[model samples]
Structure formats: structure tokens, C-alpha cells
Target: MAFDSLGRFGVWRSYTGFTPEEAREYEQLGYGTLWLGGSPPADLPVVESLLAATETITVATSIVNIWAAPAKEVAESFHRIEAGFPGRFLLGVGAGHPEHTGEYRKPYDALVEYLDELDAAGVPTQRRAVAALGPRVLKLAAERSAGALPYYVPSAHTAQARATIGPNALLATENKVVLTDDTSEAHSIADGTVGFYLGLTNYVSNLRRFGFTDADLSMPPSDRLFDAVVAHGTPEQVVARLTEHLDAGADHVGLQVLGDDYLAALRTLAPLLAARS
Candidate 1:
């Protein structure tokens, strides 16, 4: 059950925004994993594309929405990826928000049911992770999946999630990132990156649990919350901030660098991350 294959850092982006070219570039930059963030469909052609473009990089879904993608079809795709690429694909599954899915009731039960179907279909439990944040889902991830893949969380939440899932599960937490020395620019990007997620009750509730007040959870989250959730500053400062997650027991920091020029930022961050290695 060791997560030795996953390494300590990876790039996180919505699959729709990704290209094979970027995957190849990340591989050259020495990143270990490529995480496709949005809830992608079950066919997993995007996963194949990224995997095909790089030899050693592992590709994972930040999450394939349980309500949008059926487990049986997803399992079929998992088999295809496994047969073709073996240990290179990780299926990160989750129950999406109630606001987004028409049938989003009982998220915890839905996640369990979807995982049950995956079990029936012979998708090895070690190959998948749960997009979990709260205690109930995090515990279920610990008991059932390879890890807890939590998004939009601070290092404090990462530490708490590590505690919730215990030591064995991979606590791969996502951190929104921006590289800027200007305080205004950093705050601008940080607030903008998490603006939409602020509306989701699930993310809001989780932040509240970690001591974020109602004001801190507002549209443009308070400075404290935004700073904690997004890694920003110079390359060295950003590296230091990202290092906090690893220190807090995260198996990997899923770097969702916020900006129009993501690759440029990744390039700037690559050397700093490598130095840590």
C-alpha cells in the first residue's frame, strides 16, 4: 500500500484545459504525476492521451463525478487503461455538488455505492482515490480507496485530513498556486481562483470546520483564508508554502497553479521543487 509511485508533487489542471504537449513538457520538467481536475467522463480518452504522451508520468483524475459517470463504464475504462498502460492511471472519483447534479442526494452513500460497483468490476482498490474533504467521506476513503484526494484545502485542512484518514492512506491535497511578489496581484489571483468554489456548500462547510468564519467564506474569501489556500509569492516563497503540505503529512501536493500561463509558472517552479528533492 505504499504510495512510492506517486512521488511528492504533481501538476493539477482541468482535463479540458490540458493537452498532450503540456503532459510531455511536465514530464521533461521532472514532475511525477499529471492530475486532470474536472469531473471527466468515463471513457478516459484524455487519460490515455496524457499517458501516451509521456513514458513515466502517472495520470489521475482529480475526480470523475459519480453522478455524471457510471461506475460500470468507468471500470471498463479502468481495465482498458490498466491493460494498455498498467500502473500509470489512477481513478479519482467523487460525488459532485448538489447544485451541479440533479440527483446529488446522499453524497456519502453515493460514493460508497459507486465504489461498490468498482469493486464488483475488478477495478483494483489501489488504483483509485476518493475526492473527499469531510470526516465521513475521508474515513470511507481510508477504509475503501488508495487515498483521500481533497481539493480547495489549506495546509491546516491537509493536516486535519491526514489525521482523519490515518497514516496509510495517501493524502493528496490540492493547493491553488500563483507566483507573484506583488501582494495585490497575489491576492487578486488567489481570490479569483477560488471564487466559484466559494459558492459550493461542501467547500464552504469544510473551510468553516477549519475555523474560517462566515466572512472568510465570502465570495472573495478573506485574506487569511485565501493566503492559506493558495500558494503565492516568489519561487522560493511558493516552494516554502507548498512544503508545508508535505510537512503536514500530505503524500503529494497537487499543484493547481492559477493563471493564464500555467506552463510558464510550472517552469519557474520546477527548479525549486527539484532542489527539495
Candidate 2:
């Protein structure tokens, strides 16, 4: 509920990517929150583990897919963690891609139902956020939950999202960044990273809404699209790209470092980001 606890920036990683020790070190690095992506299981022991390992840093699920993680069960886990860790955990939920979820139909409706179930199960709306992309869901998130957590998007979309959600709701945008100066290497890594999301229809549809052309959405996305979505180059350059989202009305920006050595990138950026704060 205390959104300010999740400072201006956070780190986004796969649910299984961090060990308890690594989480503690990340906390030490001064980022305010650790967002676990990859739609973690209903009983979130990993979240608990990280919460236990760190003292004050917030731990949030980038999202727990509604189709895969049942509302009632996740609510139980929320209570368990809330009881032990108190105000250090935030629940982020979403309807996953249709390609993966066989039961993914009428996503907006299903998401409303899931939120209703969570409401009945005693999960406070202020403590949760919805993964929203389009206008309808963005409005729903602002009205029904704490805010929206939009993934795989640019500052242009962030600006649009801010207008839709209004000024008060938390707009935590996930940005995929490669901390390298080589243009070729950055796109090479981005191709492998951003390319997968391009396959998902929802993401493509969302991009179209933001004026991305068919050519930009092709198998190998246009350079314009790549440059717009993923931030690369020196830490200063990446920070500038992230700052654009902040200027566009993002309350929080979670960096999903794209490369094999994630901690190294985080280490490299930590001091610079802390200085900005």
C-alpha cells in the first residue's frame, strides 16, 4: 500500500534468478524493490525467501499469472507473507498470453473475476497491481487496484498509459536494457530478448495501438522499434532512456537487464542510479 517504499527504480528478474544472498546484496545496492517476473507459483516461497533475506527493500511479483496462479491460493500466500514480513510485499497479477494459457479467453473479464476473488479472500486493493497494456485494462487497474504494471513497452506508451490511468496510480514500467556501448551487440542481445515478446499477439496489438507499423512488427523488428523499446549503451545512456519514462509519468521503472551476467550489470548501474536519486 505504501507505494513510495518502491523508490524510483527497481530490478526485474526471473522468479528463480536470484538466490537469498543475491537479493540481500541487491538490497545493499540501494534499489528500493526487487520484482520477480515469470509468473511465479501460487504459493510464493521465493518471495518469502527474498523478504526474509532482506531487511527493508520491497519485494513484488512482476506478476502472478491469473490463469496459472489461483486467486484464493495466492491470497493465502499473501496473508502468510504479510503476517511475517508485514508491508514489504506487493502482489502483481495478470492474464498470461493466449499462446501459453489454454484457458485464456475474455482476459478482461477473467481478470475482473480474479480480482473479485482476491477481494473476497481479503487481499486489499491497495496492496496489489494489475498488469495492463491497453486502455480498458489500464482504466480497470486504476479504478480496481493500486495501479498498472505494463511490460515490454516504450516511453511513448508510458505517456499514453499515464493519461489513461490518470496521475495518482502507480505506473511501474518494466524496461529491458543492455548495458553495453556496442550497437551491434545491443541489438543482438535485444533481438533475442525483445524478439520473443513480439511473437505474442497481445504485445503486437498493443504496439499497433501506439502507432507501430506492420514493418516494425515483422519477424525481425525494425531498428526504430528496437531502439524505441530496449535501452542500451553506456549506463548514462540507459539511465537517460529510463529518465524519459519518468518524465512521461512513470512512478517506478524496473530494469530487466538483458544479458547472461545480470548482477554485473546491476552493480555497474547501482552507483549511478543511486546518484540520480
Candidate 3:
């Protein structure tokens, strides 16, 4: 299936904040996919808008929250996009954190039920993915959807997820990056975004699972954890760190550039990443 591919690298960003022009520019820069974050709504007009703007690049929802976006409605949106844009849309869904969702309960079971609904609604399994973190969900993602999209994860977690999902399932890992040579500045910039995820229990637990202690998960996130989670340094240094996911078994690395000028950062790293390829 065409939806099964995301090349070597892609861009991950908040879907609502993204513009059609930026999507076009991303496509021009040679990113194979745009993994939209921030839990898009069921209608997915932005997905369609970006698809309309570009001819080839894939637009995948990093996740549509399973609780917020009903399966039937999301399926309809999937069908609509598939009809118009063919294989350009990949539906990524997840059971959001308990900290944020009031209705979140028995997340694994809810995810299974959501997948069932998507199946009944005729959404192809190969065209969807799950925002999986642990082994259980990673296995579920492989079995029920195309594969797993592990968010805010380190390379160690990526390696674990790939093993859990086995050799064939897609492993599109989201990696945060701050392109700068100042290590201290990078940590400061990353803390703004990474700090929020640290507050979420699921993320914290995963960090713990991979050996991050209470100190590492601290408010500012210990420098070691920051370095492990967010790639920072000069473009070359950041790219080297981001590629760690690929080495660890990620099939595609979604670069979530953290900075004021995302496009400028992307533009700077694009050639470097391409040269590596």
C-alpha cells in the first residue's frame, strides 16, 4: 500500500498552525510526509487543503484523538481524502493521555473499540496508524493499523518499538530538534515544549521504562534526558542525533523542529539530511 511509506524523513508539526503554502514548501524541500500533530478534528479539512496544495507529499495526522474524533466521522474524512487525493492521506489515531482527556479510561480497550469502528466503517487497516508508546500498544498498532507513530520518544524507545512491532510494520518516530550550537540555549528552547510532555504520566512512565530517573524527568528535564529526547546543536550535529532513530530501527524520522522560524530551520537542515541520504 502506498500509505505504508514515509521515506527516510518527514515533518511533524501542529496541524492547525500549518499553512498550505508551508505544506507546499515542505514538499518542495523533499520531505516524504507531513505528520500533523495537535489532535486534528474529524472533518480533516486541513489535510485536504494541504493535499490540494501539493501533488506528491503525504499528509498524516500524527494523531486524531480517539476520544475527541469519533471513528465514524474520521472514517468519512478518510474516504473523502482517499477519493480525491488517492493514497496521500494516512489516518493516525491515538488514545490521548489521561491527564488531558476527561473521558479517558481503559485506553487500550478504547483503542481496540475505536479500531473496530474504523474497520466497520471501511477504513483500510493499511492506511491508518496508532500513536503507540508501550509494547502492548506497539503490538496493537502493528496488528490493527499500518504501524506505530511513537511521539516525543528517544532513540532507545524507538529501538524498542521497532522490535515490538517486528521487522515489517512502519516505525515512524517523532523526534524533536533544536538546531543550534549552544547546548545551554538548546536545552532552554526544548524545555518550553518538552517540559509539557514530561508532565504527562504516560510520557513520564515511558521515560522511566527507558531508564530516565526522577531527576531526568524534573521540570527542566535533566540535560541528559533533554539531549536524548531533543536533537540539538549545529545542523550537522542535530542531524547526526536525529539519525540515531534510523540507526535504532525507525523506518522514518519525523523532524519536529522546535524554534520560532520552523521553515528556516527546516531549510537549513534539509540539504544536510539529503546529503546524508
Candidate 4:
């Protein structure tokens, strides 16, 4: 159940902006995988279009939330896509955020129950992954699935995750990249992005664990904190920052550009990443 040929680093694209043509273009650009974000409902046709358009690239959900997509429906979609695409589809599921899910309870328990249902429905553990952050969920991800896909975390968390989950489980981390030389402007855009996650307890707690105080995690996000979370500056600098996660033990890294024009950013950074690879 290994991923077909998705390289060590992949692009995190918004599902809303993705088209069949764009999906094929990404495959042509040497992007091994495309992580679709913004919880898409279990629509096998849409998923099939994405898979059908690309020959070699893997299309994964940054996560399909348990609350929004039921295990049975997800299993149906998994089977539909895998039947056609085989190893090209990777199921990334999670217990989303409490704010998003109106009736949030013990997420760990809910996630376990969901996985149990997925298991019962015949979705292989090796074909799936979990969106995990803390120790407990990360441990569960390792035991129950192929690995964990952690978001909004720094390289230090990757090191901690690798140690906690051990060597075999896939440790993939998402890093936000803004290729702008203007520090002030970059922080402004980065701050707006960081502000949204600031309210999420999981992100806040993880930042604290990485040595950021409440002050550092404030709404505006102190410069030090911004620098830690968002990789800014030239393409070379962004590449250097992203490499930290790979060096820290991440098996793969997902890059999310801050602006709307990702093609330009991809063009700028692809060469740098190629050199690093």
C-alpha cells in the first residue's frame, strides 16, 4: 500500500481552485502528489476526475473530516477511486477541529470509533493515514494506520513525532511557504493566516510545547513566532526552512503557498527543491 511515486515533497492545493487540467499540469510539473484541503464531501465522481486526470501523481485529502464524511461513504469513495487508480489514492482522515464540528466530544475516542468502522468496512489500515498532532493521537495513528499527517507544525514537532511514532510510520508534515523578500508584508499575510489557527487549541498547545508562550501565540503573532511558523523570504530561504522538517525525520513534507498564484510560486521554488532533492 505504498504511495506510487509522489516525491518526498508535495504541493498542498485548495480543492476549490483545482481543475482537471490543473491537476494534469501539476503531474506534468513533476509534483509527485497533490494534497487537497477544505474537507471535500465523499463524492467519488469528483475524486475520480482528479485521479483520472493525472497518470502518476497521488491525490490525497489533507483530511476528510469524520463529522462531515461518514466511514461507510468514505469507504465507498476509497473503493471507487482505488479500483480505478489503485495505489494513487491515499485516504487522509481526521477528527477536524472542535469549532468546525458542532458536537465535539472526546476526539481521540471518536477517531478510534471512526477507524474501527473504516476497518469493518474493509478499508485497509495501510491505505489510510490520520491527521494527528499531540502524542496520544500520533501514537494512535502509528498503531492503527500507515502514519500521521500533521499540519501547522514546525520541524521540532516533526522530530518529536518521529521519536514518538518510531521509524517505520510515515511522518509527513505541512509547512506554509511565502516567497516574499518583504519581511513586514510577509508577516502581515502570514499573521492573517496564523491568526485563524491561533484559536485552535491543538495548534496553540503544540506551539507552547515548542517553547512559545501565550504572548508569542497572540493574535498578531510575534515576529519570532511568525518566523518559526511561516517560511518566508527568497525561494532559497524557503527551501532551506522546509528542509529542516526533512532533516528532522519527516518522510515527506507538504508545501502550501500563501498567495493565490501558486503557479508562480511553484515556478520559483521548484528549482530550489530540485537542487535540494
* Top candidate by lDDT: 2
**What is the clash tally of candidate 1?**
0
When 1 and 4 are scored with lDDT, the better candidate is 1
User: What is the lDDT of every predicted structure here?
Assistant: 0.88, 0.91, 0.89, 0.86
Model 4: per-residue Cα lDDT over 153-222, one tens digit each: 9888999999999999988789988889899879866788888899888789888999999888887888
Could you tally the backbone clashes for each prediction? 0, 0, 1, 0
Q: After superposition, how far is residue 137 of candidate 2 from its true place, in Å?
A: 0.2
217, model 2: CA deviation in Å?
1.2
Using all chains and alpha carbons, the TM-scores for the candidates as numbered come to: 0.97, 0.98, 0.98, 0.96
| C-alpha root-mean-square deviation, each candidate | 1.1, 0.9, 1.1, 1.3
Distance (Å) between predicted and true CA of 42, model 2? 0.6
Q: What lDDT tens digits, residue by residue, belong to model 3 across residues 1-277?
A: 5533466889999998789999899888988899899999999868888989999889999899999999999999999999999988889999999999987799999999999999999999999999999999999999999999998888999889988999989889999989888888887778979899888999999989988999999887888888888898888898999889989998889999988877899999898887765
lDDT by residue for model 1 over 28-147, one digit each (tens)? 898888889888998976888888888988999989999988999999999999888989888999998988988668999888899999999999888999999999999999899998
Deviation in Å, model 3, residue 122 alpha carbon: 0.6
User: What is the lDDT for 3 in model 4?
Assistant: 40
Return whichever of 1 and 4 wins on TM-score.
1
Model 2's lDDT to the true fold? 0.91
Q: Candidate 2: where is the Cα deviation over 4 Å?
A: none
For residue 269, what is the lDDT in candidate 1?
93
Rank all candidate structures by their TM-score, best first, as comma-separated numbers: 2, 3, 1, 4
